[model samples]
Target: MTSLAAPAATYAEAKDVARRLVEARLAARPLAGIPGPLPDTLDQAYQIQDAAIALWPDEIAGWKVGRVPAAPGEEASSERLAGPIFRRQVRQATPGETPFPVLVGGFAAVEAEFVIRLGADAPAGKVDWSLDEAAALVAAWHIGVETAGSPMAEINAIGGVAVAGDFGNNAGVILGPEVPGWRERPLDSMACEVTIDGRRIGTGTAASIPGGPLESLVFLLGHCAGRGLPLRAGALVATGAATGVHDIVSGQSSVVSFGALGAIACRAEPARPFALGTLAP
Candidate 1:
């Protein structure tokens, strides 16, 4: 966890940092540090994220949820954190390998994900939801891969506050086929494995996610509602990593398999700029 010794970042300061991060992301360049004062809390960090979202030339396609690991013996401020997944970065995996971009000299990793797509809009005024209520909003569950990257290589080392500030350390996602009869299946039964460069790197199941995937959706429903960013129908949610975050570099190949359901193969490419004014529809 990031120590709260520093004063919370003011809006102007947070925006400046957000601008720098957004610019670095668009240009596929690396930054030496957070461009402004480090946000002392997750709320302050999200303020920075909102500013970056406004500056980004893309629409929100989905949101990715990640665990906020608590230090030993200390309670975590929150169990999970969320970040926007831009439209341009969302890809549908096809036969053979789908390529994802990674910023060299920065943070880059891949996580096997259990994704949920919303079937209907969540009530904007609803701030609390039960597990069943959250599950009801899901259109489908799919096997996917979350591409986690940041211009700051030390983002994770800085803790959740920093990660929340920079798009939840998300770069993109590659969605695979929907898992049929997912509702009746225990998440832990949907075992997953991540292999990078022909070597198995990580393995686990949705059971590893605290409380399970629907609980993650429950958290997001409230988290977004509180921020006035109510989730829309068709939005996707990448529940926390099923296996674990495994590091990779440019040119490496990886495959994330969701047993019996399907698998998505991806190759990493050196990240390229988003071309100054380009925006995805």
Candidate 2:
């Protein structure tokens, strides 16, 4: 087996490395013995995850989710796919207008999603919020693209120390048009497709998400709360992909179509290959 990268040399160094990369929107390079495979709880997961982003001195946008079940669609309930998004990246921006500098790589994948922008406060009271309750607070809904490099074999294989060193598998997000029906729309019945150079690559149904969108919010609410973050009204939550995963590479443009709702497109820009250790700074 390929042995995992050494953990950070110390707790402080691990925190600093994670912070530097997150804030700078750079890659993660951990020191030996720092990022150990021991932070098992969701709370611990966010501490490392959040702190990395916290290193950025910008206003946090919202949250991104993955590993949600794909039921009544195609998943066999065994392979749980997941990743993260910068809170700020989840905003209701124009299709091509975004502040983050997107690095271009041909290995891009577009996933269609319904975005839920919070319209109310999600206090961490002892009550279990219902799906409808979570939906009621939506400010708007839009189609989007969640892209990353081709699934790295190491990232797909390891979930702890290794994932941390990879910047939480985040690449970029593109927001499309806002739906009018918003919260009242039935997401499960919605369908979408992934297109590369105008060719259909994959198709998916919203029902792939176990309980649809609110289910994603429920999971996200707790994930943030566990990290001491209250769900603010302006936050946007991406439910998950509507179509199957689509992979792409550089010099190519990709788009995800969710039928009449709308489609988000991103043209990949070339990125220079950075040596593994280049992320250390």
Candidate 3:
């Protein structure tokens, strides 16, 4: 088992790093090295993540789950990581609504995702949740796009620990229409395709997400419980990308189709400028 205890010195350093990136926004550059010391384990990484969340001063609108490729000889069951998505950055769009704004130079990318909106609170302290129990918490599901961005440009290259340290590289989310009676749908077998500017960019299914969406929720439930993060009612949880991540630029249009389940389309625009006081918890 991994140790959950992280040094106090390291925690403070991680918090400062997150504060600088949050304040810098699109202007923040990738660090050549994390100050104090780099986190060497998932527990340490999440410690940095929790500290960073405290510094952001915004209500968490949702969370984005991403699979961390398992290390050689590591079990597949232990390969998921999560990050927060602030409420100010979450947006909802219909098939032909206005485009979503995302940071242009700030590690912008798009991912086709399966998103669940929780109906009941999954309070902290309970860590053992079955896939069915996790699924029962979902109020609805949607075909959506996660606007992936990070203040640090080299976050992806730095690995999952770094990714977790900076809100899991999430910038924004575009929610499409809810899939009514989603409980009856066969999510794992559903096909999804992403197209940008009318050209196909990627294709995949829920099967690509480790253990599928419900199981991913189970992992997240346990993770947040362990970290003392509350999973409140109405919070949106986006399962990992189905179609692979695709680079996107400001002013580009994207369309994600989840076969007969539904489709969502939106264009991306340059992020608006904001002062530090704009974000609040």
- The alpha-carbon lDDT assigned to residue 252 of candidate 3 equals 87
Task: State the C-alpha lDDT per candidate.
Answer: 0.90, 0.55, 0.76
In TM-score terms, candidate 1 sits at 0.94
lDDT score for residue 56 of model 1: 91
lDDT of 3 by residue, 78-165 (tens): 4788999899878886648447766655667789998989999996798999988898888988878898877555566656776777
In model 3, what lDDT does residue 133 have?
Answer: 85
How well does each candidate superpose onto the true structure, as a TM-score? 0.94, 0.73, 0.86
Q: State the lDDT at 235 in candidate 2.
A: 74
TM-score of 2: 0.73
18-106 in candidate 1: lDDT tens per residue? 88899889888897767778888899999999999999988999999998745466665447999999998999998999999999988
Angstrom error of the Cα, residue 111, model 2: value is 1.7
How far does residue 277 in candidate 1 sit from its true spot (Å)?
6.9
How do these models rank on lDDT, best leading?
1, 3, 2
- lDDT at 258, model 3: 87
| Backbone collisions counted per model | 0, 19, 2
Q: lDDT of model 1 at residue 70?
A: 55
* Alpha carbon lDDT at 177, candidate 2: 78
